[model samples]
Target: MWKKWMVCVLTLILSMPVVACEANPAPESQPAQQTLPYRIEVLADQLDVPWAMDIASDGRIFFTERPGRVRVIQSGKLLSEPLISFPAPFISEGEGGLLGLVLDPDFANNHYLYVYHTYKEGEVTFNRVLRLREANHAAQIDKVLLDKIPGSSIHNGGRIKIGLDQRLYITTGDAHEPIIAQDRASLAGKILRINLDGTIPADNPFSGSPVYSYGHRNPQGIAWHPDTGILYSSEHGQTAHDEINRIEPGANYGWPVISGEQQKEGMKSPLLQSGDTTWAPSGMTFVSKGPWKGQLLVANLRGKQLQKISLDATRPDTVLEAATLFQDEFGRLRDVVEGKDGILYLLTNNRDGRGNPREGDDKIIRLVPIQP
Candidate 1:
């Protein structure tokens, strides 16, 4: 009886599954596994080629439609009418129209807003950055500051932001002319910085000009690191090598001559390269003061995803591609910005005639990061 009992006990023990546990795992330790802690929720739909966005102090999100209207979203609903609309002369063909929008740092006091758009003058035309103030009425325009800068219907780089130094920084594309990127006299394919009143800062690299850095090809997204204060930009590559670069004053980012990491003397290589056909990156935002703090969030148009890159540990110099979310559901993500409440807001680009749209197409999505 004892031998039979022993055999049965041995068989039961052998059949049970075995689990290996670490001898001294910390009680509060998190697993090393990487995961996306956000749930993407669609806020509103039926937008047309929405390019960029700025969140107002009152939590209203204002964004631009490439065809010349600026719209707002409040409390999960899109406003019925445009806040402001430009004349037809300000809207050009392909890559032109109302492109970028930013609020003045002292907007509460000055009520100033800036915009970048393509304008026409008889036969000659150019992309111009304009500053306007809110008139006594909410939807009226008051002023224009600094207009005319050389434009093309195809490659108008229209991204503007106010830097920590209280200066406006603008990113311009190559205007489909590769050589223009290297021309010091041309504003095409360059990053520029200027004072709020539209004057070049005396501390700028180019004495009397707003040129901060040169040699870019269709740069769309610009963001500053939370800890380092260093600026990071996303560039669109022609056929290959989409890049993310760390911006420095007077530094030249190679455009037509070099795409990725070519050993050139004066050019700076991208910290990360998307390579040929994988990603066409657009607007980016850094997630600060959350579980995702220190991670760079990038919106991809062609790839149709929101990619996160962890850069807090490094000096914003290393590029580590993290979990990509919302690619299959959103169609194309154009711009991403972090809300004051720690939620991530995304602008979908499906209505731009370049993506496949479903029932709720061309929408603004809010992603709330959840605790894992």
Candidate 2:
């Protein structure tokens, strides 16, 4: 009877389910991959060395081809014909050609746009800013806002923007002459501020000169903080020490005398400097919305990336972090602009003679935010 009871108990225990445990638990099933904050979309492709671009309030994009054509993109399509082709031929040597474009603050009403380009004045290379008036989807040179800025095959600084004060701000390169950066009288290697009519403002740093700041090696980009109203500029260093400077009204940024954290008496050092790394930074803008809102995005050419900068919350001049994106994904980014819809647009420079062009060669890429 006892043996029969033991057999019955053993059978009951055997009928019960057997459970097993894993020592590693299969690594938690490998969590899902996180999505990126933004995705890239090719808005316009097959462009020819698009240098700079600006979006109008009406969602029209006006950009310049380095080969002297002012192209337009309207309603999600690139216009086959240029809005206005310059009657005068451009120098178009080395890095010289058409560059820098911006729309007027009152663009919707006045339909005015501005451009900077390299020109030849009796065999001497120079740069100038011209105002264009658009009517019936075509534009004409309305006025020459400023003229006779020193230009060269290289170092022809040509980024223009209207500041919060409604004044036109222009960046000029050293024209490969570093010494001229320290010369207060020279327009090259300096930031100039003028009225929309191209007149020097009464409150300029110098009593009668338009020189806002001097001692820039080759400032290719400038942007203002939306809330702080502080101005920032990106300059190409001698070779490696590319700089991002907080611009002041009369400050002398050390160029030839100092670079890459080298400080001198009465000279301002860069807020951020690339040590032994060449960014060739150009055409920056403060992001208005999305994941990068309130930060600064700069387009890099030689470094071939988009640099994102985060400023310190307490100290407006301090940079908390600087990160790079899309390294080598797009060959030689030239300009980055933030649209009214909070999207960022990038222009690739694959056909700039320095990069290996792919099938499309150059393209306009938009950073579309991934919605939650």
Index of the highest-lDDT prediction: 2
Mark the regions of model 2 whose C-alpha exceeds 4 Å error after superposition: 1-35
lDDT of 1 at 33: 55
Per-residue lDDT of candidate 1, residues 13-103 (tens digit): 3354433222111122112255656776888787888888888787778888988888888777887888788886786477788898988
lDDT for each residue of candidate 2 in 78-169, tens digit (9 for 90 to 100): 99999887756567888888899999999999999999999998878999999999999889999998888898999988999999999999
lDDT of each: 0.77, 0.85
- Provide the lDDT at 242 for model 2: 86
Worst 10 residues of 2 by lDDT: 22-31
* TM-score of structure candidate 1: 0.86
